[model samples]
Every structure is written in C-alpha cells, then in structure tokens.
Target: MSSPPDPEDLTARARIRDAAMRHFGEHGFEKATIRGIAETAGVSSGLVRHHFGSKEALHAACDEYVLRTVRKLNEETWAAIKEGDLAKASATRRPSGRYHRYVARSLIDGGASELFDEMVGMSEAWFTGFVKGDGEPDVPVRDRAAVVTAWGLAIPILFEHLSRAFGVDLSTPEGDIRLASALLDIYSHPMMSPEEAAAARAGLERAARRSTTEGTST
Candidate 1:
C-alpha cells in the first residue's frame, strides 16, 4: 500500500486557502489560477482540487472562513464591551495581517451577501446597545448601522484614493502613522460643540417630521 500522505501534506489545505485568498484578494477570481495558488502555497494543483474540488468551491470556502472569523471577532468584542473592557474590544477588532484583504475583495466581488448582512446586523446591534444607549440616534439604528457598515467597507474600495489624498502609500509605516494621526485628530477634536450637534440633530428630526406630515397629507 502507498505510504500515507506526509504529515506536512496534511496541513496543505490551510496553506492553499490562505494562498487562494491572497490571490483572489489581489486579483479577481477570473485572474487567479489554481496553479498560481498552488505555487504560492507550495503544494500541487492536484492537491488544491483534492481539497476544494474547484475554483468556485475554493472561493466558497474562503467566504465561509471570512464569515466565521468575523463572527468570532464580533462575539469577542461584544463580550469585552459587556464587561466594560473597551480596550479589549478595540483590540479584538484589529486583526493582524492580510486576512482582511479578502474581506474587501468579497465585498467587491458580490455573493457575500450572507457575510455582509451578518456584519450589518452586528453593527446595528452595537449601535443600538452602546452608541446611542443613552439617547436616540440621529437616524434609526438600523439605517445608521448600515451607513456605518458602508463607510467601513468603502475603505478598501477607496484605498487608492485615500493613498493619493494622503500622498503616501497606505501599506507603508509612514502611511499608517499619518492615517492613525489623522483619525486621532478627527475623533479627539469634535468639529461641532455639544449644542451645535444637538441643534443639528433637532433640525433633522424636525425635517423628518415635516416630511412625514406632508406624506400623510398626500
């Protein structure tokens, strides 16, 4: 009988998946090839087929992996938040490495609706539970969460534009510093005072009411 596949060979499945995600993230499905993925993973194309059967199946597996990862992270974040350990929650959201590349790719490639919807639901729950826990959101929590999710997803899609605007490649250390500094400034220094923000929200509520009254009349 043929000797069992080497122990190293048994671990090829995860390597292939990681390599496929990298390829699919950098290049779309049509551009990424099984041979290229196998080469990156240091495995055989036959092994890729043996594990996932086909490119589409590999892609589906990647989606499942991403979904599972996000769900786990969100759960950890939620638990941290409940315990008032915001630092832990923040850390939970900051995953290390190129894994997130596939998240951006999945958003762009379509057919990740389950993943997207799951994120939206988690975002809605977060906004409802914490962001506006003491008061009403300017918009409904679900709508607000959806918009926030869109904005978060837009980062990868708009990465090039942001890099150009910042005049630095976002993949570099300097770019990370610059971007983090900018975000810090934006979050720390509110553009509007409490009164101004309250007034704006009130105005929005008034406009919403007016629109509702007009619709009722019609």
Candidate 2:
C-alpha cells in the first residue's frame, strides 16, 4: 500500500516539460540532452523519463501543448466572431511568443517535422472552416494560408535580426503590439486595384507557361 504520488510531484512534471521545451528551443531537439533538461528543471534524468517515458514522447507532449493553446485561442476568437465583434475576436487571438525562439531554432535545425506539419494542418483546417462552408480548402486558399502562417507568424519569430533592424524586440509585449499593428495596417488596406490584380495574374500565368515550356524542352 504505497501512497499515491504527491500533487507537487505532478506539478514538477509540468516544470520538466517547460524546461525541456526551452532546451529544445535553445539547443535543438537532437542537441538537447535528457540529462541537461532534467538538470535545468531541477529533476533527475530518471524522474524525467519516469514522467515522460522518452525524449520523443516528451517532444510530442510539447507539440500537443502548443496545439491545444492555439486551439483555445481559436475557440475564443471564434466565439467573439459569432457575437459579431470582429475587433474583439481579433484581439482575443494572441499566442504567447515565449516559445518563439524555440520554434525558430527548430525551423533552422530542420527537425521537429511532426510538430511543424501538425501546426500547419491545424491552421489550414481552422481557416478552411471559416470559409463559406465546411469543405476542404481549394489550392489557392490552402497555399495562401500556409504562406501566411510561415511568413506572418513563424518568420518574424525566426529572424530576430529583423527586430534590431526594425528597432523593436518582437519577443516583448510592446514590440509584439507594434508588430501586430503594422501587420494589421497592411492586411486592412488593399495594396492593388482589380486591374493590377488581373495584370499580376497574367504575369504569373506567363511565368508558369515559360517554366513548363523550358521543362519540356529539356
């Protein structure tokens, strides 16, 4: 009749996960050792294994945590939209930038493929749902959504070099707000007229045709 694990121990498990995410973000998945993470979390390597089973499983847990957080933000934003409060809905959608460095490192390392795909899939599904009906997105919409997720969200975090150039640290609260405001300004305003859009499409079509012809010629 051994006693159940203490509630504090359960809490320590969360701390371990947090430490692991930070290490993975800073050192990358393959480079981040289990012992290093455990030491960072103030726990033994055996305890970390006891809680998370293995490094791969622990990484999965971290990805799932991020997914759930994004899903919750989406749910809140959706509720606000249903209430006819677009401003409120947009304001409600704020994902923490704490893990931004980790994500950027992961991107550069070319590891964490599972986490990346899952995040992109979730974004695609969410955007698809917002369109006219519950149908899969057409190629253009899906392509746009994927690009937006990468450039609009991930790139900003990945390239902190931009922060220095822009005179703002995007990891901070005020800086994030400033970046968001700049993004909103661009998104809210139309950059081109219908005629320009048509011309751009024609140009793209010509480029595609040229590429196809060159490929067939070879």
Candidate 3:
C-alpha cells in the first residue's frame, strides 16, 4: 500500500503555517504577528490573511496541524514499540524534534488546554491497551496517562534549564545524546524501592480522601 502524504510539504500555505508555529512558540500568542510570520515564510501579509483570515484563525490552524502531526508521530512510536524495532522508534526523535519546542510552548499558551487534554486522552487509550489483566490496575489508566503526558510535556518546556545544567545546547543532537545518557542512568537507578512506593501511594490516597471529604463537607 502507498504511504500517507507527508504533512510538511513545501507549499506556500504549509510554509506560512510552519513559520507561524515557530513564531508563536518563540514569541507566544500575544506577541507573535501575522506580518512577522509572513516575512519568515517569504509571503505577503495580505497572502497570509488570504490563506488564514486572522491571526487567531491562523493559530487555530496551527493547533490543528500540530495535533495531527503529534498523533501521527505517536502512532509511529507505538507501532515501532510493538514490533520491537528500537532503531525505528529512535528515528522518531529527529522529525519530532523539529516541532518539540513549539509543542512545549503551545501547551502553556492560552487556549491550548483542549490540546493538552486531547493528548492526555490519547495516552489514556494507549495505556489502557497495556493493561495485561482483567482486574483493576493499581492506578487508573486515565490518571496514569495524564501524569505521563504532563511529564513528557515538561521536558521540552524545561529545555533551557536542562541545557544550562548540562552545559550544552539541547536543541542540537550532541546535547540531546548527553541528556539522554544521563536519563538512561536515571532510569537504570530507581529512586524508590517497591516498599517505599507502596507506602507513598497509601499516603497519597489518604491525603486525597481527606481533601475530597473536606471539600464535600463545606
């Protein structure tokens, strides 16, 4: 079967959208302008407006584009994992890196809660598939997935901090490898033992129950 069309085409409209994404990521929604995005895309402001109406409308288009791209990348990753193809899964980093900064910034930009929630919902479905037993999981899939999604979002959002700590520019491949190496060390060494984790979970549950009770009592 033929492969699906790549979304990052060289068309004028795609260029404008990509430029707008980068601008919005770097400058945020309030500061980024249609004219600036047009200049970056090598198009006229009028053309940008012609293609996307207004800045708000253009941003909405970007939201749609990024979500679609992320969904595609997520599927590729899961497929690679299922096939035990480490090389293929690792390759996703390159294409995804191009948009990583934008996604990280976009999440915190106003009105992106829908995007964040959609990502959580997407991960929840995937986590549910990993449930091996018919019995209840120790943690609910939605809760677990939401936390994991937030953690994933945090990496790019904290890129500058990570880069400064490592003394390397993480946007580059070498710095990425350095950070990944440290992360490997971290993953290899679990911070908490199973006993500690069980204890923590119990404490958290108690705290949650107490908070809920207090809220309902008022």
Query: How many collisions per candidate?
Result: 0, 1, 0
Candidate 3 vs. true structure, TM-score: 0.81
Q: For candidate 1, which ten residues in a row score worst on lDDT?
A: 1-10
Model 2 clash number = 1
Question: Residue by residue across 1-218, what tens digits does model 1's lDDT show?
Answer: 11233354358798899899999989988899999999999999999999999999999998887787788778887888788875565556555225657777777778579877888998988776665333555567778778778876776667778889999976666666676568658756879888999899899999999999999999
Score candidate 2 by TM-score against the native: 0.76
The residue-by-residue lDDT of candidate 2 on 1-218, one tens digit each, is 11233354368888898898899888888889899999999999999999999999898888777665556666676677678875665555434465667667766777557656665676676666653533444356667666766775565354487678669876666666666677868776768876896799899999999999999999
Off by over 4 Å in 2: 1-10, 81-95, 121-139
Error of 1 at 214 (Å): 12
TM-score of each: 0.71, 0.76, 0.81
Clashing pairs in 2: 25-102
Which scores greater on lDDT, model 2 or model 3?
3
**Candidate 3 lDDT, 106-181, residue by residue in tens:** 7776556767898898888776774254357687788888997888778888988888989988767777667667
What is the model-wide C-alpha lDDT for candidate 2? 0.71
lDDT of each: 0.78, 0.71, 0.80
Could you tell me the lDDT of residue 107 within candidate 1? 78
Candidate 1 ranges with C-alpha deviation above 4 Å: 1-10, 159-218
